[model samples]
Target: MRAMAYRGPYKVRVEDRDMPCIEHPNDAIVKVSLAAICGSDLHLYHGMMPDTRVGHTFGHEFVGSVHEVGPSVQNLKPGDRVMVPFNVYCGSCYFCARGLYSNCHNVNANATAVGGIYGYSHTCGGYDGGQGEYVRVPFADVGPALIPEWMHEEDAVLLTDAVATGYFGAQLADIAEGDTVVVFGAGPIGLFAAQSSWLMGAGRVIVVDHLEYRLEKARTLAHAEVYNFAEYDDIVVELKKATDYLGADVAIDAVGAEADGNLLQHVTSAKFKLQGGSPVALNWAIDAVRKGGTISIMGAYGPMFSAVKFGDALNKGLTLRMNQCPVKRQWPRLFEHVRNGYLTPREIVTHRVPLEHIAEGYHLFSSKLDGCIKTLVLPHAG
Candidate 1:
């Protein structure tokens, strides 16, 4: 099988690798039919996960047909198509019992929280990703992934990560019928946040991003008001005006470490705040939100042992809720949203390419120089 392997910083290559086989009695081997590069993938692309092995396959957001299943996997069969959750979990764990599968307490024991995940590293359980032709899924019978037949592979792929992230953002925000939501970053996660907020009954959803194309997608495709955070001299003032000075009840920062300006300046400038891949977005979201509001941070972050605005949080009385979207929690509901047509989140896919062109796909998505919002990788395409 040909899998994209991490070589080092800003490097990846499609390399021949062994096809994964089920190792656990409850495992299932899925033939990846549709997989998309996630904003989170950028971490490895940029070598943020320093702990990730040199040649490990790197992807987690994918949907495919079950190629094979172990004898204990009774609920799923060889022919069943499924969406794999980014978080690998043991359903019987303490955190899993409490509905926090990401912190399953059975995997990534060294992690401070429930931290086992695919395509991550020793800090995250070192599970191989699904970016290749096949992937091994442990505890598939109990993990958040569900085999839904009513959905297309392309559309259902997001149930694993992007859609769940969006749903989790709304869930963390406690979106309600009358609450207003402001989502930062019009990237894939941001777009999904806007859509999820609307579905959860937000009176108005306003998404912020500098990209013209992304803002357009938010307006016409997602049907939400947008703010060009670039043009606004006083973003707080403009957002206040849009929300009648109360500001949004919930503010979600979907842009991770990429929130800084030029890499050179931001790297050399004041190094305060969370020192992860995308903490600037968090700062902006905090200041943009109202005095008392909820902020959900779902953007994928690497390791950063640092402080991030505890004073502002203390002063503003902000309720900060964050996670990797905990793909395990939102998978079921996200699948329902897609199957029932409540969230057409796959609209973010601007380009689709075969597995042979994985390099080009990475280029298109990594730089995002074009209007490429989401790039889907086709492993079995001709």
Candidate 2:
């Protein structure tokens, strides 16, 4: 079978690799119907993740058909379609018992912890990911949920990542009725975060990003106000102006670089920092936050160590809750959102490419061109 393997740092190639088989009783085999590229996958490509070396199949968000399941997998069968949860938890761990499935003691616990994850790393369970013809899914019975009857496979793909991350972001921010919220980054995660914030009763939701196209999408589709970081010399001023001189009650960082740094300098002063950008979302939120606001950092943090100005954190008395999306905990509820037609996170998908054209897709998406918010890869469509 052919898999898009990381032949080297930033060098991805489509190559023949062994097809995966069920190696554990709790495992299930998914025939790759569709898989979407994620922001985290970029970390691996840039060689920022641990042991993200040659030959790793890179992808975690997927909606696929179950072609086989082990005997122990009762709820799921060969014919049932499901969305693979990004996190694999045994549902009985110290963390899982408390509903903190992201920190599952079994699969993908933390680097300072123990866990497993598909195609992530040995530190993340070193399990094979779903970027190939067939990939094994661990903890299948407990992890893989049937795609709700009203959901389409492409649309349900968000349940595997972006939408879940969005819900996770708003939940962390403690958004409530009549609260004004701000989301930095208009990419898929940020877009979803804005939608989720509005759904959670936020009085107003504002999305900040440089892309005019993205900002338009946020306003027209997600129905949120947008701030063009590129146009405004000071985004804080611009965002505050939109929010009555005060800041938003909650600020969610969906762009995961130096916390929200973009490619170019001067779009944000922090973006041009020679001292180094450190989750500018922290600084952006601090600058544009109401006195007692909440900051939620849910973007993928790479290994390169950096620092944020916590002085603002102390002064603002902001409640900082940071974590990767514990998809295990957010999936069920997000699916509920999908079922009600309250949220359609997949609407951000701008590119749907055959797996073989991943190189082209990656280039187009990495460039953020033509309003390519997200790209879905169909590995077995060939």
Candidate 3:
């Protein structure tokens, strides 16, 4: 098998590796059909995530066919095409029974926070991801669903994480009818969050980012107002002004660890590793929302201390909601949205790279080169 191996910070390569075998009675071995290099994967690539061991593959968004299944995996058989949600969890666990699959208590050793995630760092769970020819899926009956005959493969793959997480982010915002929603970041998640806000009855949607390309995507794809924070003297003040000095009704933080507006914050968190993640975007979300409004955090952050504005949030009486998204929980509504033509998830895909060129794909996405919005990995591409 060929898998993407992490060499070090900002380094990765596809190399031959031993094929994964079913290790649990409920496990299944999936032959990778399609995989994606996600924004979360970049945290590992940039060394922002702790315990991202060398030789560990980094990928969580993927769709594939069942190559083999253990005796206990009764729902699927060989050659069954499926889209595996990024979460790895036991369906009957305390959290899982409540539909909080991302926080399942039975999986990961460090299950105090997030549950098992494929190909994420050891903090989430040290399971190998699907950025390879094949991957072993635990609790196979609970996580992987057969791809719908009417759905596009690209859409199925994106639904594994980015699409699901984005919709979940908007759901967490608790948007009300005719409310104005502000989204921080124009990445795939932010774009989806902005789009989902409209479906949830938001009257206005605003997306903020430093890149013009992504902002343009916000305008066209999400149909939201776009702002380049780099062009503003104070984006928070501008946001207030745009909202008639009251501030937006809701704000979502989709930029997590590597937010770049504040040099000091970026350097301290992303460069020096002093803080868990740069809170510039999150703090901006805090300041940009109305006093009694809600803020949703969809960004991925390290599990360390961050310079958050907890005091201000307390004073303003803002409702802060955040969690690693329960991916499968969002699928039913998302599938309907996709089927109803409200969302075209594959439209956001800007690049597709073969498995052999995964390192280059990582470089392209990490560097934000060539107007790259989303990059899919073709593990079996010829």
CA lDDT scores, all candidates in order: 0.77, 0.76, 0.89
Candidate 3 has a TM-score of 0.96
The order by descending lDDT is 3, 1, 2
Clashes of 3: 0
> TM-score for each prediction?
0.91, 0.91, 0.96
Residues 1-382 of candidate 2: C-alpha lDDT, one tens digit per residue: 8777877655777888777888888788898888888866765665556667577787788878898888788889998888887887788878888877777776653465545566775567666677777788888878888887878888777678888888889889998899998888877888888888887899888888777888899998778987777666678888878778877888988877542243332134445522222366557877788888889987776555445668878887888898766786786677677778888776788888888888777667766667787899988775
Question: Which scores better on TM-score, 2 or 3?
Answer: 3
RMSD of each: 2.9, 3.0, 2.5
| Candidate 2 Cα errors over 4 Å, as ranges | 108-110, 258-270, 273-278
List candidate 1 stretches off by more than 4 Å: 144-146, 259-277, 305-307
**Clashes per candidate, residues 3 or more apart or on different chains:** 4, 9, 0
Q: Candidate 3: what lDDT? A: 0.89
What value does the lDDT take at residue 116 in candidate 2? 59
Q: Say which candidate scores most in lDDT.
A: 3
- As a whole number from 0 to 100, the lDDT of residue 195 in candidate 2 is 88
Highest-TM-score candidate: 3
